[model samples]
Target: MIKILKYTEYLYLAVAIASIYKIITLWGVAQQETYIFIFFAVISIAMFLFRRNYRRKFEKRKQDNQN
Candidate 1:
């Protein structure tokens, strides 16, 4: 379960990277689409950070309970 959580955190990062790439590629050709990608990239990065923090806290709490 912990491993799954870790993988999902990375998945969010991957999505953010992909969104950034799309934004760059479509910047000039499609302004509206680029904006959407930009929003996605921002949200993805935010989610990645949020999940990482939550995961760390969860691990710490688990460790504390064990010891």
Candidate 2:
């Protein structure tokens, strides 16, 4: 479970990247829809970065506790 949580960072990162690509592809086709995708992409990036930072801090605390 801990391992899965750790790896979810990668999943979020992937989704962010995919969202960016989708936005790029939709540039000319759907300007209005792009705004929603952009919002999601930005949120995904923030979540991915925050999760990675939080996980690192958690791991450090866990290691300190074990020692």
Candidate 3:
């Protein structure tokens, strides 16, 4: 579980960083490409946040089970 969480965190960070890079290079591109980069960034951050919340819930459940 810990390994998976760590991997997810890295993946999300990578996607976000990539999107920012894309935006910085979007000078000669069309508007649609810019939108796509923004969308990817938003979704990646949302997934990261949601997974973090879920992990807290899972930890709570584990604690309850141990008790």
Which one wins on lDDT?
1
Q: Poorest 10 consecutive residues of model 1 by lDDT?
A: 1-10
Spell out the clash pairs found in candidate 1.
Answer: none
Cα RMSD for candidates in order: 0.4, 1.0, 1.7
Q: Residue 12 lDDT in model 1? A: 97
Candidate 3, which segments miss by more than 4 Å at Cα? none
Clashing pairs in 3: none
Ranking by lDDT: 1, 2, 3
TM-score of 1: 0.98
Write one digit per residue (lDDT tens) for candidate 2, span 1-67: 5588778988888888998998999989999988988988999899999988998898889999999
TM values, all candidates? 0.98, 0.91, 0.81
Alpha-carbon runs more than 4 Å astray in model 2: none
Model 1, residue 32: C-alpha shift (Å): 0.5
